[model samples]
Target: MKCIIVNDDSEMRKTIGKLIGHSRGMKLLSVFNSTSEAALFLRDNCVDLVFFDIQMYDVKNLEFIQNISERTFVIYIPEFSPFVNTTKKPQLEQLSESTIAKRFKKGVDEARIFLKLIKKEKPDILDDYFVI
Candidate 1:
């Protein structure tokens, strides 16, 4: 799967980027330290997966995520577990908050598993991660 990393922390970006690179059947297309740069890149390019932080400068990450094609899956690396109120966001309403919590709590293991499940296209395993 083609992917990108968008995080303000350089270490976080590198860690996630390396995880993607080390994973089988995944490609790290690019990495951006800011959401604005990422948004510019996303406007012209199509990617299979995006791993990004929920808190970004100026832009509301949910709005940016909503603007992207539904075909692309998003895995949010939120600052903390249970931070986002899913009900407030229309795009995230269908997904389970518990699942998102588990993801945020598990770190790299969850990310690796998410990508693997996505690659296999198994909705059952994927149901634990995201809905769309």
Candidate 2:
């Protein structure tokens, strides 16, 4: 899957990009520190998934995603994001890993649970693969 990371912190963006890059079926297309840059890029391009930070230095995450509602899947990675409303959004899944190590070295059980939740919530992302 083609993916991008949007965060003001360059280190955070790289960390997240590495995780996505190392994933089995995911590709890190690009990482941007500004939402405006990401937004402009998304306007004329297509991405399979967007991993966005809720609190960017100069942008509102929700507003940016709202402006790009063109069949792209979004996964919010925020410190204080609310999951209470995630269940109501189609193909939305809450990722709780707060650190690169936690995401990259997650245990099999945790990975299994995360994968199951993602598959159940966003089956279209995995429909072509027999397993992920």
For TM-score, the strongest prediction is 1
RMSD for each model, in Å, please?
Answer: 9.0, 9.9
Q: Show pairs that collide, candidate 1.
A: none
**Compared with the true structure, what per-residue lDDT tens digits does model 2 show for residues 24-122?**
777777888778889898888777667777666674666786786444555656533353455453222243455334644443233345455565777
Which tens-of-lDDT digit does each residue in 1-132 have in candidate 1? 778888876755765675676667778889987777888899999887788787766456767777765556777765433545554533343446556445533554555666666668786764455632
Angstrom error at residue 24, model 2: 1.7
How many clashing residue pairs, candidate 1?
0
What clash count goes with each model? 0, 0
Q: What is the lDDT of residue 118 in candidate 1?
A: 61
Name the lDDT value of residue 19 in candidate 1.
61
- Model 2, position 57, has a per-residue lDDT of 62
